[model samples]
Target: MSIKKNRLSQNGIYGPLTQKTLRNLLKKELITNFGFENMHIIADILIDRFLKIISECSVEKERIKPYQTIVFAVDRNQRFGYGKTMSQTKLIPVTVNIITHQELEELASGKYLKDLRPKIVTRILKEAYAQGGVLSLNDVAIICGVPNTIIKKAMRDYYKQHPDEILPHIGTIFDCGATMTHKRIIIKLYLSGLLTKEISEKTNHHPFNVDSYISSFEQVRGLYEEGKGVQQIAFFTGFSQSLVKEYIQIIKELNQLQNNNKPNGLMSLTS
Candidate 1:
């Protein structure tokens, strides 16, 4: 560390990255890099104006308070996706800002709009998930002051419009036994020709999970194409009958869509 940074770390009240500490660092950088005689004066004027104008962003001119909460979620780094059992997966507390003051203001303005609730639900889901927090539908329902059904509808709509992007939620993240939703999303991405890592990042799923889902899909594909029943495929692949049925259903849907678009070919969803 530099001599100046060493002092700040030892004595600064809010650590070395607070607004005041950063302002001093910027001023020093200006003086050192440009070798200007009056750079201190210029830096003070610019930095002060910046801090003042940015602080005015809040309508009350007070600090804006984000709607934040902490929840426990699977530690992404600790996950051993696909073949490994998830019993050893560790859960860690993640602090998330559900919505910013600015976003709340926007939603408050659209109170009477029919789509307002759905929009609010999706926004909160995305923000919390982006921060590595997985919220349940019930959690969102409470936050939105609505029924769980409303949250479910919003999630369904979000997936319909953005099938390539999976919303990280409790069920999707730490799904242990049942893999209905995650399986469908992963299989859809695989059938569309996305590689394992690409599908993992796009769907916000662990790569191990992606690989496992692909393997299960391939296991069922041949038997179904050969006119075998769901039970037959399940018996052959050792997957649950429900999973076998899901794979077959998705295969039919994707094949039909692919056939319909044969003239122009499927559009690249990666874009």
Candidate 2:
């Protein structure tokens, strides 16, 4: 019987078999050796054992030193062995280079850094700004294979040196703490529906700061609906009573305008 050769090697004694052929051969062997009834159970046991062996081999392979090579001989005709007798076997020597995860990362990073040029950094920043005004230092560092600290320093230095060009692209810059505090106050008062007094007390911030934080929303009628007087709203929101009353009046006027702007037919339908 002529044996089929594997694509990897023409003269090897045992070549790789296709998944379908291997399965069919295993099924036939199990049926002949253990009968039809016991075939599936025996095959399952064999498969589980083979999988365990494969997992162990994978772990051992990982434990091997990086760049270390292992040479081994494989018998190609082992599948044709029958009843203590073996067919003419050919031994093929194979060499495998072992590489650890860290080694692979280092090699990949080296290649990335080698390919990256000074102009590429500027282009990366430009692309980042085009996508969004904000760019992540860690993301850019990962792409360029540089440390985040180095990337941040380089960006800050570049922006300072060329503010005319870089500042316009990057957009407004504010202290992170101040920006976060401003957002937190707005979210607490508006989205969270917390009282201005509650936000001021919790944040230990001035009432004026809270009012300024929520000024962007341009409305404050909910404070009045909550049964808070103008004085109380001013105390909590950091706005003067006059400002609070003014804001409430503005909100009322805006509501009245919206009501008047509705078509008479739609207003009648709702009524």
Judged by lDDT, which candidate is best? 1
Give a tens-digit lDDT track for model 1, residues 1-271: 9999888777776563455676776677768786754767777898798667544332341332356655555566545335664356554455545555766677688755345555667776666667565666787887766789878887777777776566676566545434376777777677666799988788877777778777877778878878889888988889889888888877777677766786434432222
Q: Which candidate number has the best TM-score?
A: 1
The regions of model 1 sitting more than 4 angstroms off are 1-66, 80-89, 176-182, 263-271
Kindly list the per-residue Cα lDDT of model 2 for residues 1-271, writing each as its tens digit.
Answer: 3354353355343434343464556666767775755568778678667655545435365555655432222222222222322134332323233333554576677744333333344555444333323333454565556787676566555645553232211111111221232333333344345667776555434445456556633434556667778788888777767667666664454446447865322212111
What are the runs in model 2 whose C-alpha is more than 4 Å off?
A: 1-120, 131-134, 164-271
Error of 2 at 241 (Å): 23
Model 1 RMSD vs true structure: 13.5
Local distance difference test values of all predictions, in order: 0.67, 0.46
Clashing pairs in 1: 82-208
**Position 258, candidate 1: lDDT:** 66
Model 2, C-alpha of 135: deviation from truth (Å): 3.8
Q: Compute each candidate's TM-score over C-alphas.
A: 0.62, 0.22
